[model samples]
Target: MTIHSVPGDFHIPFDDLKVVARGLVRPECVLALDDGSLVTAHGQGGYSIISSVGEVSHHLAHCDTARKYVPNGIALAPNGKMLFADLGNQYGGIFSLDRHGHLETVLDSVDGTSLPPSNFVMVDEHDVLWFTVSTRNVPRSKSWNHHVRDGFIGVIDGDGARIVADGLGYTNEIAFSPDRRWVYVNETYAQRISRYPLTGSAAKPRLGKRETLVQLSEADLPDGLAFDVAGGLWVTCIASNKVLLVRPDRTVQVIVEDSDPAHVGRIAAGIRESSLEHADMQTPGNSRLGNVSSIAFGGRDMRTAYLGCLLDDCVRSFRSPIPGVALPHRSRRIR
Candidate 1:
């Protein structure tokens, strides 16, 4: 693999993240609901609808189709259906939640092969569904063995499903530029952000040259990503508890980092709520948040940034200085 480098020097520090809820077990994906609430996919198995007051308004588990469903990332369809990507060793697939709160399978296999461990899902303005399979291995723990490069990026639509890029190093969250000219992805195990120019029509998109935007040490693992209106990419690093903002010009800033690396790992292990020792726990720099896995921007004016934590019971949130680019298919009303 050829390494593409871009040079830029910038580091900004701001650790003012506050927890908005608690009791949410391993919330992986958190997105805004039009009715001023937030919906999240929990790692244990199911989804939770949370309110700003830190209350779990609703909760739903997997349907019979995906008995072993382990949700990772989630998105909403135009008609109010919720789409989710699940991760599991045996059978991983995409599931959907209808208005009646019923879960159903969307796709379990692409071509003739069952999905490896699905990570993130993104829907474009053209309604093309783009997702990432972190690795070909069933259990995600084996992904640490960097020797295999089976990670791939795929797109699905009415026509069918096919991989657009392969040989990635544990691909995580996938995002697109506002103009839809570039695609950004988090290569977690590689500790780098890889991007490629997106071309061709909406129905038949293609990836161009691959380039590295930001690189970090092995201590950091980039997990989820979001984009601001100005094209700045916000990345969540789970291991180091850091949030980085990468600008279009290649300059990067550390917007959030407040945790002990070793401590954060234990938190990410999905400890039971009864096992947490509040007195023994220490939060870095007095920040109220830790062990975050994903982030999404929404709320009034699109400046509210909601963070998904792997260990914590609730999502953390803060007011972003810049408004985020409204995501496609976001519902304007809640059923």
Candidate 2:
């Protein structure tokens, strides 16, 4: 499968970007729909719905009074429910939120082991659910080192939920290839993007051997994964505030970036020395993008790029030269 590269001269100008939605807290994951609306992961609890006209409304969960709702990655189910990964302080799990704000537990424990701070979740076209756990470390921040490899990917379908792949180096996000033949994921601590071929029966699915697609540098701790219609993979880096494009040919391009060299250097050093502290990732040097963490394509043409961030209160938007691969939820309504 030969994939060509995007135009070398194409890049997103920071000055031309616009704010799509505001007053969001830790909007770490954004899912754009065909009608120009967006659903992003809310830091405080549950998720927020941004209407096409820029109206914002929150549907927070009141499931647990003791545990704070720290949603990381989110997905829009075909039935209009929102599936969010609970990154709670002491525990982690995947939960679903209905239109009425009713919450239901999807998976809190798998294979007799309780999930540890779930990171990302996705519902594919077939209604099959997939998720990732960045690491098994108690604090999770302890696995910020490149050497930690307890991360894994799990799937839920007709056969029930089970881990299909393990030994990942801090998996952050996962995306299926355009044809749904391959599953791609970003290993944040390992600084690489890897993919596995889809094999076996649909009911009893399996993933083939992992293939390294992109080995990134410490400065680019990949956090998000999205595929453009042209076969390019767009990755968002947390500390450096960079959006990179990995072409089908495996060549890399910096589509946009805003960073403080000194701050990025400190983060890189901590990762290299396996001493990264949670405090180190608390604040980003640049406030413009709030350490952009995720990217999504929306709008009528699917050429509008929406950025999710760790520290920002809004999702940023920009025009892209290439249209993005339409996600399974693009045509689904929030109801």
Backbone clash count for every predicted candidate, in the order shown: 1, 0
Runs off by more than 4 Å, candidate 1? 1-15, 52-54, 62-66, 261-290, 332-335
lDDT of 2 by residue, 130-176 (tens): 99999989898899888999999998998888999999999889998
Q: lDDT per residue, candidate 1, 51-156, as tens digits?
A: 7566785556535553667788887766567778887756677877765667777777887898866887766678788889898875555555335567889888
lDDT of each: 0.73, 0.89
- Evaluate model 1: give its lDDT: 0.73
**TM-scores of the models, in the order given:** 0.84, 0.97
